[model samples]
Target: MAESNKHLPRLLCLHGGGTSAMIFKIQTRRLQWALRSTFKFVFVDGPFTSGAGPGVLPAFAGCDPYFRWLNPESQTAEQDQRRVRQLLSKVIKDDGGEFVGVLGFSQGARLTAGLLADQEEQNAAEGMPNWKFGVMLCGSFPPLSLSFAKMPSTKPSQGTDEHGETREPDEDEIIHVPSVLVRGTLDPHGEKGRRLVKYFDPETAIAMVFKMGHHLPGAAGDTTSDKGDTQKIVDAILKVYADHLPYEELKAPKTTVMENRNGQLSA
Candidate 1:
């Protein structure tokens, strides 16, 4: 590895539903290439396989094997949550460094949002690493019943109660981490993406809209290969890291991280 990339901060890259890490990697090749110098992207396959599910992306039509972070048919929300937490923990341990950030598309983005929210509610003693920021590309918010949905608000709100006296509302749960939400104007899930953004603090979240469809576009209106769009995404990712994590932390060694089915960590 080049000296500049030797200590580059690691970012967990989550693939969309019905798309494996390998597939997503290819899908976002240009963007990833542009960002490789500044960040080490770790792409992981989701736990559930997409078996003839309705509404799966057309690109996965004959892919034979596809994956997802959550499977409503075979797993409950709690089970899926535990699986994600374990996978992240194992990856961090295997890498010999903590994940500075996360970048996800579609279902993966949704999972990332949920994870960040969950981290907000956790006690420091739990030993989970707090991600500095996240990039959610076409992601959605998890159900309110999840732990991330319970994050207590640190900011005060100014509003009048039923009594007509001005006062701050009770501390409500909110994800405090800064996030960049990327949405395609033509995507059917665009509305869901908007709803997810509303869950975060208005001041901390940034929403970027592209002119294309469901997938991560390379240019303003091009879904596949637009150098300009790729650079924009790359810039957005780097900015989030720069605004949050220390520069010194970005220069950490890369190591092998893996987890067994039992959730035991090993390198």
Candidate 2:
């Protein structure tokens, strides 16, 4: 199965704050297994090192040297934004100009939303390719500083007044790319996750709620119910992928999911 997907289109993966690419790869092994036939995943680390994030310990113990995208303790916002922009450039360049999708967890998911929004506002002359789609898992509301970093300010004085606060993104600034938003019913950030959907095109966005906490659907023990939820997510992803393919490519038979008597879904 792995060998068959070696040539599949890639999905660039971003880990949550306080986790490294290695840990995220291990964390999402099951999901990768499910989607192995459709997409290959590329995991990348954040630039800044940090402590472990929520739900990272115990399970990921001994996997030291966690990381974060932004330094909340930093006093200079502009410097932080500069580093983030650099990371964005590096990731896009590393993608080799292919139409890569994205999947992110927690803080990474928030950053994913911000990146899509930024892609929407960036000029074509800038040469930044838009992400094909996004799978945001348990993400919180995007930080305004990051989400609207590249967007032009609507207020006078270059989108900021004497207070130096950047203006909010207009409705047009919201991204329209296909997306699957995974929310955890037990996560404290449920409300924030709901708010994050407002940043994407509602028409192309699909939101799913799992019965777990601040982690992937099947991470908690991988029970039958969890597997069912994960299968649902996989189905949603495959459906969106097929829907976005060019008509000629659609000639290939589309994948379908079936629900068994045990109430489990299978592809």
Candidate 3:
């Protein structure tokens, strides 16, 4: 952590299942390089150690250490959330900095979404940080047990009908923060990702898609001889901070505005 970076807005980075902060740092090296000067990233390891399961072997092949936010079979969603809350409390207490946003991939993304949903209901609770933005890569809706589905919708219906009968309000769970959702066109979780993005208020959420697979694409995987896909991810995140975050001094990098197309903006 550089002394200069200490003054920049901080982003809490969460890794996916079967991955550690180290692995995720390696995976997003390109994006970090691009945004290093603008944002300070704090990568945290998950609470649960990797266990024997499908994809765990290949995902952690030589990676002696790996982690997950929770193990569904062994722990309940509430237990996992409590652990997350404790970890975040410690981070905020010891880091002496406020987190402006969060960036997560895969399983980590699911946890991020869940935490935001929880914060909507628990903002007044002690030791919780109110994140201004979130960037979810290949994320899905948290499981029903996580209670995100049970959160009350923040957007109420407009005026009453002609007969003075108030229209029923839309009952969708809303995440009140600027968010960037990145998904891969070829990823098997594409449908789930779309569902999760739809859960948020469309006006505040930006959906971006690439032609790659499940993995986060970076400079090492670039073959187009142009700006790598990770650059686009970084750009989207910076845009969210610039347009919505309450940081007066942070300037958004000049770039083309991304439009949502077919539920996703191309990278």
What digit string (tens of lDDT, one per residue) describes model 2 on residues 1-267? 655765788787889989989999988887898888778887888878999998888888889899987787987666776676677567767766464677888888977777677666663213345677888888876523343345324334435433343344357767787788887767877667766776777567777766677888767553423656777787777766666788676333344444344434455
Q: Ranking under TM-score, best-scoring first? A: 2, 3, 1
Residue pairs in collision within model 3: none
For candidate 1, write residues 67-186 as lDDT tens digits: 877766853565665666676667777876556787888878887776676667673213346788888987754412224334323344355344222332233446778777877667
Ranking 2 against 3 by TM-score, winner: 2
**Model 3 segments beyond 4 Å from truth?**
52-60, 122-125, 143-172, 219-226, 245-248, 253-267
In the order shown, the candidates' Cα RMSDs to the true structure are 11.5, 6.1, 7.3
- Report lDDT per candidate: 0.64, 0.71, 0.68
Highest TM-score against the true fold, candidate: 2
Error of 3 at 267 (Å): 10
Query: Residue-wise lDDT of candidate 3 within 131-176, one digit each (tens)?
Result: 7888898876541223423432234545644322233323445676
Worst 10 residues of 3 by lDDT: 143-152
